[model samples]
Target: MKNIIITGTSRGIGFEMVKLFAEAGHNVLALSRNSKPISDLNLKNVSALSFDISDESEIVKLGGYLQTAMKKVDILINNAGYLVSKSFSELSSQEFKECYIVNVLGPATLMRTVLPFMKKDGHVVNISSMGGVQGSVKFPGLSAYSSSKGAILTLTELLAEEYKESGPSFNALAIGSVQTEMLEEAFPGLKAPLLPIEMAEYIMDFSLTGNKFYNGKILQVSSTTP
Candidate 1:
């Protein structure tokens, strides 16, 4: 069983992923800002760590903690992210910076910190969005969020190329609109978003077997298979 690290586990997709991986007997390191509700399924091999992803100091501390563990991380899931939906004109510089910090900087920093502890067969899965893909339709209030995710896509491609010789794969999953806290926060009145647990199950399965086929490709997780 692989040792996997996942961020943003307090709720939503990250929380579900922790359940899925732990149930599958993988050693899971779950990180989030708040302490997640304890689960019997996760008690076996899941560890919960709390830190704000947007804080560089906190990430550095986490890096030190993981370094001390000295165990090679088999899989790293850059799943912690946030969205602030507002028109470009309405968005402040502070908001843009905050988005960049969480969406782009946090993943990049985590990847850097974990790289030395990753084995040759390790994999890094970046959680991007359809807004990051080329030819995706533009949405007015999502400029900052889309831009950050788009940068993540580019980072994924670059890392895939950089680690090609090492045999550790890097890929990005441009998930479709899933039913999560972030979606509800973005569109409060919207109904029928995909459930977080369902999406997490799909992601866990994909991470186990789909990397060989999907490395460096943006796979969409939507209701209808394309």
Candidate 2:
């Protein structure tokens, strides 16, 4: 079984992923701002932590924990994301910062912190948004959220190239709308075609095998736009 680390596990896709991976006999480290949701599951193969990805100290702590506990990581899924839907003219600088911190900076930092614990066959899966893909349909209120995701797409490619010869492969998934709490909060009344569990299953499978077929590539997984 592989040792997998998944972020944003308090709810939605992350939550489902934790269950799926553990049920499949993998060791899972579930991280989120609120750990109770996963903690209550009581899965033997799963360990949950209240992690704030935007905090540098927390990231450092995570690195230490992996060094001592896991020793090596097989899969790292950067799934946590932040979004704020507001008119461009009314968007605050702080709002933009918050978006980038959670969506871009946090995941980028996480990859760096986890790199030392990964092997050549390891995989780093970055969860992105369809809105971030250039030429894809764009929405007005997501300037900050979409742009931050776009940054992750480029960062994935650059990192993959930088470490091509040494080891772990990096790739991104530009996903579409899903029926999630974050979706309801950001765009009320809009129904998404996909469910969180469905997406999580795809990611779980990819995290295990995608590295063999692709690297530094952004796979657009969407049938609808936000």
Candidate 3:
């Protein structure tokens, strides 16, 4: 069984991912700002950690703790993210900075911290957005969020190239509008979005296949019937 680490497990997609992975017999290190709500599940394979991913110092401490624990992570899912919608003209500099901190720097910091402890056959899954795709239309108030996800896509490609021959794999998953807290936060008027459990299931299935065809490529997930 794989030892997987997933960030942002408090709710939504991250929470569902934790449940799915643990049920699949993998040992999951689930981290988020808050404890997972399903505390009653009592799964022996799941451990919950709480920390603010935007804080580099906290992440460094987590890295030290993991090293001391000597638990090698086979999969790293950079799933924690945020979205603050405001028109470019109305968005303050500080707001943009905060977006970058959580959406970009957090993942970068985690990847750096865990790199040394990752096994040769490890996998890195970056949760990007459909907005990151080329020529994607811009949402009026999503400049910061879109740009950050776009950067993540580039980062994924670069990492995949860097690790191509060294072992392990890096890929970016461009998720479409999924029913999650973030989506509701971005569009409060919308009645419903894609369910989190469905998305989580698809992601877990994709990861377990050991398919290299998608490595260094972006896999987009949407609710549209194929």
Candidate 4:
């Protein structure tokens, strides 16, 4: 069975991913800021880790745990993210910084920590957003979120090129809104046609086998339901 690592396991996309991976019999290292919900799942193949992605000290400790917990990770999905919707005039600098910290830097740091443990031909999928998709769909109050995803797109391209021969395949999924708490918060009272379970299935398949021939791609995974 492959070893998989996924972040943001407290709920939504992360939660569904853990469920699908463990049920598929893969060894899963599920990380979340509040992992108690995952622990309650009681799945043997899933190991829940509690820590915010933005917390460096927590990430360092998790790195240590990873050293002894598994010899190789076949997939690393940087699925953790944050969003704060505010108009340009109302958005604070601190909020912008925090958004980038969770949405961009956290993934970068985690990737660095887990690189040595990645198996040959491993896959790394960074969860991005259609909100960040250039010239496609633009929302009014997502400057921080959009820019952060743009940064992720760049990182995916650079990393894919930097380790073309040795490192894992890197890609970003610029997904549209999926039905989740995060989505509800981002656009209150609006319903998304896509579901978290559907996204999880796609991610599991991609991480397990589909991405072997792809690299540096920023795929727009979305249903055209506006």
Candidate 5:
């Protein structure tokens, strides 16, 4: 089985993903802002660590911890992000910076630090939002969140091309809205078209097989209903 590292694993999709990988017998390293949920799992194949992804010092600590056991990481899922719903004029520069750090910089820093441990033909799956894509339906309150995800999409392509010779692929999944706490925070009255577990299953399959057919792509996950 592959060695997989997933960020934002305290709850929602990331939490489900760790269970998916662990149950399948892969070596899973799960990172989160709080470790209680993952710690409670008690899965033999899973190791949970807690750290705020937006903090550089914390990221460094995570890197150092991984250096000991991960000679080769088969997959890295940059799944942690922060979100705040507010109109552009109401949003502060600090809010944008915070969103950018968690959504973009955290992944970039973690990806760079983990590069050496990535095995050949391994994959990096960046979690994004459909709202990040250029042609997506614009939501006024999601400007900061969508923009941060857009930036990650760009990074995915750049990294994939830059590491072409190394054989490890990078791709971004601009996921459709899933029924998670994040979505509830974004749209309180609406029901999502997908659930976290379903998205986790899709992500797992794509991480294992999509790199061969599609690398450096921003695959949008959405439904016809909107």
Candidate 6:
């Protein structure tokens, strides 16, 4: 079984993904600021850690854990996110920093720290948003969130190129609206075509098998108009 690491596992798709991987007999490291939800599951193959992606010290702590426990990582899924529905004019500098820290910097730092533990054939899947895609339909209140996600999309491509000849593949998924808490927070009363668990299932499959066929690629996963 592969040694897998997933971020933002306290709820939503990330939470569902932990269970999926563990049930499939894979060793899972579930990371979240609030680890109680996963810890309560008590899954045999899953280790739940209270992780703050924005903290450099936490990343260092995780690296030590990897060295001692999970000698190698087969998959790393950057599924954690931060968002706020505020107009561009209303978004404060601190708010923007918070969004970027979680959506871009955190993932980038995590990948750098985890690369040494991943094999050449391993996969790194970044969870982006449809709003982040260039030329896609845009929204007014997501300036900070969507722009940060866009940054991650570019980061994924650059990393894939840098490691193309040496190691693990990197890919980003620009997913459309899903019935997640984040969605409700951003666009209340809006009904999405997909559910958190449904998206989790798809993401789980891609994290395992998509690397062979795709790297430095942004897959737009949406059924609605572009």
RMSD of 1: 2.0
Per-residue lDDT of candidate 4, residues 21-84 (tens digit): 8998999999998989999989988999888889888878878898899878889999998988
Q: Which residue pairs show backbone clashes in model 1? A: 179-194
lDDT of 2 by residue, 1-226 (tens): 9999999999999999999999999999999999999999899889999999999899999998998889999999999999999999999999999999999999999999999999899999999999899999899899999999999999999999999998799999999999999999999999999999999999999999999999999999988643
TM-score of each: 0.93, 0.98, 0.93, 0.97, 0.97, 0.98
- lDDT for model 5 comes to 0.90
Which residue pairs collide in model 2, if any? none
TM-score, prediction 3: 0.93
lDDT of 5 by residue, 1-226 (tens): 9999999999899999999999999999898989999999899789898778888898777777877877688999999989999999999999999999999999999998888888668999999988789887878888899899999999999998999888689999998889999889778977887899999999999998988898899998887434
What stretches of model 2 exceed 4 Å from their correct place?
none
* lDDT values, one for every candidate: 0.83, 0.95, 0.83, 0.88, 0.90, 0.95
Off by over 4 Å in 3: 36-40, 191-193, 224-226
Residue pairs with colliding backbones in model 6 are none
Candidate 5: segments with Cα more than 4 A from true spot: none
Deviation (Å) of 8 in candidate 1 = 0.7
Off by over 4 Å in 1: 38-42, 224-226
* Candidate 3 residue-wise lDDT, 56-175, digit = tens: 998999988787664698888988998889999999998898888888899998998988888657888989888777676666888988899999999988988887887468888888
Better of 1 and 2 by TM-score: 2
Clashes of 5: 0
lDDT of 1 by residue, 115-198 (tens): 888876788899998887778766889888999999999999998888888857888888888878889889897764578998
